[model samples]
Target chain A: METNTKILACEYQYLESSELGQVLTWLEEYGEKAAVLAGGTDLLVKMKMGNLQPDCVIYIKKIAELDYIKDDADALRIGATTSLATIERNEVVKTYYSALYEAVRSMAAVSIRNMGTIGGNLGNASPAADTAPPLLVYDATLKLVSQQGERLVPLNEFFVGPSQSVLKPNEIIAEIIIPKLGPDSGSSFLKLGRVSADIAKINVAVYMLRSGSKCESCRIAFGSVAPTPIRVPQAEAMLNGKEINEELLGAAAQAGAAEIKPITDNRSTKAYRQKVSKVILQEALQAAWQRAGGAL
Target chain B: MERKWVKIKVNGKERQLYLKPNDLLLNVLRDELGLMGAKYGCGIGECGACTVLVNGRPMLSCLILAVTMDGQEITTVEGLGDYDQLHPLQQSFLDHGAIQCGFCTPGMLVTAKGLLDENPNPSEEEIRDYLRGNLCRCTGYTAIVKAVKEASKAV
Candidate 1:
């Protein structure tokens, strides 16, 4: 009775739940056997490729509760199922958080973004995820909820490796909280892919906070250059509280390049990534600096 | 295998379907509804050949589960036009010779219609950006772009 050639060869019982409490109970009961379906852009692909064979397909997108973006005093809290298109076009996100906007803008394509959710992007935990670099630069956090309750985790510690995250089988990402940028601060995200809307070969995002010509603080992160999208604390340290100039930024970029471990993959070579990592970091730094009203 | 009954509005008509858990919306649209407009190209979300409008937005039908689309409104290429009268975008595509293999036509038309519905008059760059998910390997993008531009005026 095997009707082969079915896109999803794995057989699973579809459990439809439109309530968050019910979804959490199912996740707790089914454990790893249950695969939560968010946007299906990533989950369905893995299932079709036979990479995952979950016995239960939990369709939680109908839970209307997990889809809102709220602005608070010092941070913006976004529900997990909020579509990338929504975030990309969000007025508050675009006006202030340009890096996050540009990051979403440079993702897969319009159709994908129309269905793709921020939760799925981080949940799948692709090292080259376009949303990662910018979210890293923004110092975002996640609220993972289970039947037992919820726990908060920083975005920095979320990823373990390729296609991995700290998410437990019974837990679901309920919310993403991104801290608001301070005064005189600006951020930029830059990605280079095979084409305009392709998986990133290498992507960099830089955030700068400056007081006149003095660099108060900065964060530089890159994707597709390591096992996990990472921040270059060494580079940020070099520019921290220092009057940024071209020479200093160039030195910091070089230092940042020395800190990463990029691999040779189909998207690019280790050598190419190693060389351009420094260049993009420098350019990102200069752009961030300029946006922060710094002279350089 | 057990099948679930679901209701969907296809091209303005209400349709009730019995679908399996693994049944994709693309397969259901093509096989059951006889809406051959959405093609199965990549089987994945990469190629735009299976694009369809779900709830007023262009989405990858290949990735969408037919079971999950209960009560959703879908628009395929069949919804666009007929032999006698064509949708402005369909006519424009023909006028500009935008069809090469004809595999990507349905996706292109549906996605373009979705774009125009949202923004009545989109810039050339906007059209190109919106159509990034719909791939035409025939190198007929210039003509496709021209067609979309011309249709924007008529739409």
Candidate 2:
């Protein structure tokens, strides 16, 4: 066929259970045999490509407990099924977590954002997921639910490899909790996609707490650089408790370029990603510094 | 193999039909309902050819299961306007010479309608950004962009 006109193979049985209790029961019953469908943007594409063919499809977007974003006692709680579009336009997210806001805004087109959910992006476990870099820097924690019980897992420990996570077959990500940052803190996200709204070849996110001219704390993360979206601790350590300056940012960028393990892929090559890693890191850190209210 | 009676409101009218669980919304609209406006350009969500407004927001119909849309409102290109009275965006598209091969017109019109409905008046950058997923290989998108901008004024 010139084009793959066939959309879905129509092989699996659709199981719609939007209630949290009902979905949990279905997950308990189907276990590995069931695939949860939230946004269906990624799952349907994989199914159409013959990469996945689960016996049962569990619809969770309508789950009452998993489609909101609001303030908890000490953290910002985001429901897994909340659409990216909703998060993008949220004033709290834009004002407080600029990196996450920018990440969601740069994710895809308007239609895809309207359909795709934050949970779907995390669950898909792609190294190129735009949400991961920002969330990692935000130190977000994911709440995974199953028939057994709910467990809180840090987003840092969530991804094990490409298209992989610590999630079991019966467990679903219910909510994401991001702890509030200090008022003096600021963050930024930068992405280099082939097009304005395409999968990123390289993405960077930086978060810092500004204490006068010195940076008291920092978090730096990169996507599409390694087996999974990873944090650059060594590079971040360079900026911690140091005076915010252009020279230190340059040094941190050099260290970051050496630390990240980029690979030659369809989107970019190891050499090219390495060559530009320093530049991307420098620009991203400078933006983050400026956002942190640093003059230099 | 599971069959269900799916109920959806399309073009201000309600439809109830027996369908397979895996039937895509695009297929249901085109094959079952005979709404040929939403094209099947790309089965994947990357291409916006199967774009349709579900519950007032643009969504790729091919990525959605028909049964999942039960009780939801779907507005296809057919819902916008008829031949008797073309939608403002449709007329602007025609006036701006936006229709080249016409494969991408239906999706462009509906997506542009969504932008205008939300923003009322979007800049050229906003118009282009909102329609990023909808592809037009024929006209290089300048005419389409102009058409959307012109429609913004008339609407």
Candidate 3:
């Protein structure tokens, strides 16, 4: 029954957990040797490329409690194993979290979205992850669970570096909580890729809250321009409580671009990213502003 | 690693097979079941040459672990039809000359079948968007899109 195809190497046990308790028990027993498989979109790719070879892969897609999208009193709670396609098709997500919806829609393709999960996107912690910028602008929080207990970490602090996160070996990302946007608040996500299906070269997400003719609050985030998805607090401070206009948006865009640290990579040059960051931020801001009931 | 017995429904028939934890669905389909219609262009999911229907949804078999797909319904190109009686999409592809190198035709046809299953009548733009995962270097997509459009009417 054996063929000459290059199969995944390394001895491993595939365990499917139907309950959170069973996953925790398995994690506690196997800990460092176990890799959690949610969608297997990224994990399998990495394993095929010989980049990762875990001794055990714990599949959590069977955990019923871990695949849900519920609207709580204050925010939307998305289970870690919930597929991107579910979020893209959900009426609530489409209406309330359009930035997330757009980002999810713009990800790989229809089939990948059907199999890839929001948790897998965040868990991979790629600087160019399409969901991170939108999640950051949404002020999302990640709930991490372990055998000991659960802890919630703000999305901004969850990432430490490229392909790294604060997640402990025995802990799993249980849910992502995205706060509901207040009235007169609008958000948008924009990504510049080499092709329609390629990964983003430079992406930006903007969230704006307007009051009358003034900007009450603003949050700007960029991807592929830093080690992790980051918010431009300096840019936010400049736009807060200020009258938003084309000239002001230009200034904010420059400030935001100057604040990011981008490195030249295979996808794009650092200079190109630094330049496009401003353009995409301005574009996102204008779109968000129009959505927030602002003119021009 | 110990081999585990997994039961799955391929096309319409129920099947039980012993598989390793890391065995891919693509390998199991082609090697074990002799379903050679699904090609192996890219071992990764980037290319849709290994596309198949998992629970009536288009998915890359290259990325799916066979053990994790237990009890799921799978459909490959071989399940569609034979030379005597071809599926409507297959007929349209042949009529429209959409098969060039033919390496990517199976993936394209399977993915198009999934799209038409979900959306009986799709606009040209919708067909392009849905089949963006399936890459065909031969036909430049014009004839394939036309074939899907023609098959939509027939189906």
Candidate 4:
């Protein structure tokens, strides 16, 4: 028998890891009736706002395997419970994926990063999730697990709508997989938030491979300006084998801006976000190109 | 719910508490154990005023569940050096005039302590990046960055 309680304006449930197997059974026993709690950064906020009142919160922090950073050949496996601070400091990510490092570095201040996890950010599926655009450019994949088994989903296909993900009730985001980069490849992440501490009004990520003075292959992604973190294929196609010139950048920026569909929110206006996104995208792409062995 | 007796080395003393099912680490430190050094600025983890050191890493107490810290060590603002002997970072904040209303000081100091502990030598940009979560309404962060650098030099 599960007992229910309330405290500090949020509904609460406490469960032990030993019982997780039972809880998973219970979740399957009562499908879509319970919610799993990881960092509780967003869930608790929603609870405080009276938006989410979960009948049961299966706390996953007690599961020891959920918190780690492991580097396998050709890819990095970041556990769902791994905090953003850990990612910001991990030498592997800093060396291999500078864009991700910068995104984690610029995310909500130190304390919030210390407690917030990358899996939680992705699970929340906000259009403004700072890491999503960068991860999209990297072609990152997500591994979600439930009692039945495990499944892998492309990061781009993970989100179906705002605040909605494909994760099932019993399933949990287990790990994030970032593929290895090839030669002449470099990445960059940039955001235009109200402050250094606030969420991104418009965030851009660029991944480029430079051959001589021209871009070999490139990917540009942006968040908070579309229904989801989207890839600007037109912008990317315009840059292929093209010299990094003001004319080419102007064309790509225009294409990138035209690809997004932004909405006005409390943090920024639709027009301002659409405008700033182009500038940020151009700058971030230029920076990334430079890092990929290209002269300014 | 299963209740467990959790032990933590808080400040200079060891504490054993039977935390309730819904008790947060911030509530346990403030309400149950009377460690007011860690404030409850925001219950939802936006504000950095509730930061404390969990195993030498800066963590938001509001987001940590008390029972989750079974054998972990915690350091609050009060844990850093006492009134008789102050930590260099504490002294630097005072000398640099980093305190405004004193509401954000303890949290700022604790956050800075974690940064300096990890990297005794941080650049100006690194210092700014490390303390990004801590918000101060008064000094705008020019002096806070200076204080962290000064404290690093002193230590």
Off by over 4 Å in 2: A1-5
TM-score of each: 0.97, 0.98, 0.97, 0.92
After superposition, which runs of candidate 3 have C-alpha atoms over 4 Å from their true positions?
A: A1-6
CAPRI-style quality class for the chain A–B interface of candidate 1: medium
Question: When only chain A is evaluated, what TM-score does every model earn?
Answer: 0.96, 0.97, 0.97, 0.93
Instruction: Write down the RMSD of candidate 1 (Cα, Å).
Output: 1.7
Whichever of 2 and 3 has more DockQ, that candidate is 2
In the predicted model 3, the residue pairs found to clash are none
**Best candidate, lDDT:** 1
lDDT of 2 by residue, A28-75 (tens): 999988999989888888888778889999998878779999976699
Backbone Cα, N, C clashes tallied per candidate: 0, 0, 0, 3
Candidate 1: where is the Cα deviation over 4 Å?
A1-6
lDDT of 2 by residue, B11-51 (tens): 89999989898889999999999999999887886778989
Question: How much of the real interface does each model capture, measured as fnat?
Answer: 0.66, 0.85, 0.65, 0.55
* Model 1 agreement with the true structure over A69-103: per-residue lDDT tens digits: 99999899999999999998799998888888889
TM-score of 3: 0.97
Give per-residue CA lDDT, model 4, range A85-192, as digits (tens): 889889999997989999998888877777788999999889989999989999999998878978999998998778888988777888999988877889999988
Give the Å shift of residue B87 in candidate 2: 1.2
What are the RMSD figures for all models against the true structure? Answer: 1.7, 1.3, 2.0, 3.4
Give the C-alpha interface root-mean-square deviation per candidate: 1.7, 1.3, 1.7, 3.6
For model 2 chain B, the run of ten residues with the poorest summed lDDT? B39-48
Indicate the residue-level lDDT of A236 in model 2.
93
In DockQ terms, which candidate is top?
2
